[model samples]
Target: MTQIRSRPRSELFAAGVLVTATAILVAQFLTATPTAVVVGDESTRLGTVGWQFGLHDVVVIAVAACAVGASTTALLNGIGSSSATSADTTCSDTSTQESTDSTSSELLQARRQEWETVSERLASNEEQVYQAVLDADGVLPQSEIVNRTELSKATVSRTLDSLEAKNLVERKRRGMGNIVLLT
Candidate 1:
């Protein structure tokens, strides 16, 4: 099956701005009040109505301004932060990442098989947390393990500590996050 990917945020934001502007213009055209009023005097052919600010107009203007500002900010950030890369650079990075991912998956599969061998002796929560880590390429962040297993952070941490004591997994500090690795 072919996957349908979404456009970048800046593109979506710009499109939104355009669509909103078009809708506002169409609505104004369809429901516009007259800009001129005829007086009962013959001195003037037509007296142009003075400018009047309505709450609706003010609201619309504010919304449009906000949309435009957001769209422009997104576009500018995308442009300024983008760095040029040659095809060779991109292909090299992609190939490296693919190899790393393949190795990780292989390790994870082996870890799963090992877990299956001793899963009968494991408690339900421990098994669940272990399986979650095994599914994560043998290395995952503790927070991600919690999210995947649908367990509370405290529960995941305690289970991980227990697993570490049994030599089934290893937890190490990685920056501000804890990285769990299958042993």
Candidate 2:
């Protein structure tokens, strides 16, 4: 599994610092004016500029500066949020994979248990079929066993093969059918 790291603190801090510096610079620029007119210089008093005065200009500059600051803050916050979301997504994927693996393991265990139960049932069925043949004087046709057990041909055939391999039954070919004898 892969580990996801959080957004770097330094990048967030730098963004904050940049926004703050921009606001400060905008404030300084808006308030800045030519030096005050000297009382002793008549020409300087007439020529020196004072703070610009206009309701519209002040409103426009203030609005523009605020918009810049707001947009910058929004951009930074968006980046941080996106990074956090990506990290969360990675964690979610890991959790999902773990759940899938656990489910698959559980399914495999269930299948193995089912196979064991089936094997036990098959062994029991084979024993019953063998006893039936012995009770019938050691000679029982495959059809009779199939009719008695109500099992499929393939299953009966496999069981008889297993019984023969165990030396519990002997097989003799007779025409198209096999005569099974309990040994």
Q: Quick one: best lDDT, which candidate?
A: 1
Residues 53-113 of candidate 1: C-alpha lDDT, one tens digit per residue:
4678767766766776776666655532322222224545777767766765576577688
Best by TM-score: 1
Runs in model 2 deviating more than 4 A are 1-122
Candidate 1 — which pairs collide?
Answer: none
Q: What's the TM-score of every candidate structure?
A: 0.41, 0.33
How high is the lDDT of residue 93 in model 1? 78
**Residue 47 shift from truth in candidate 1, angstroms:** 99
Residue 45, model 1: lDDT of: 48
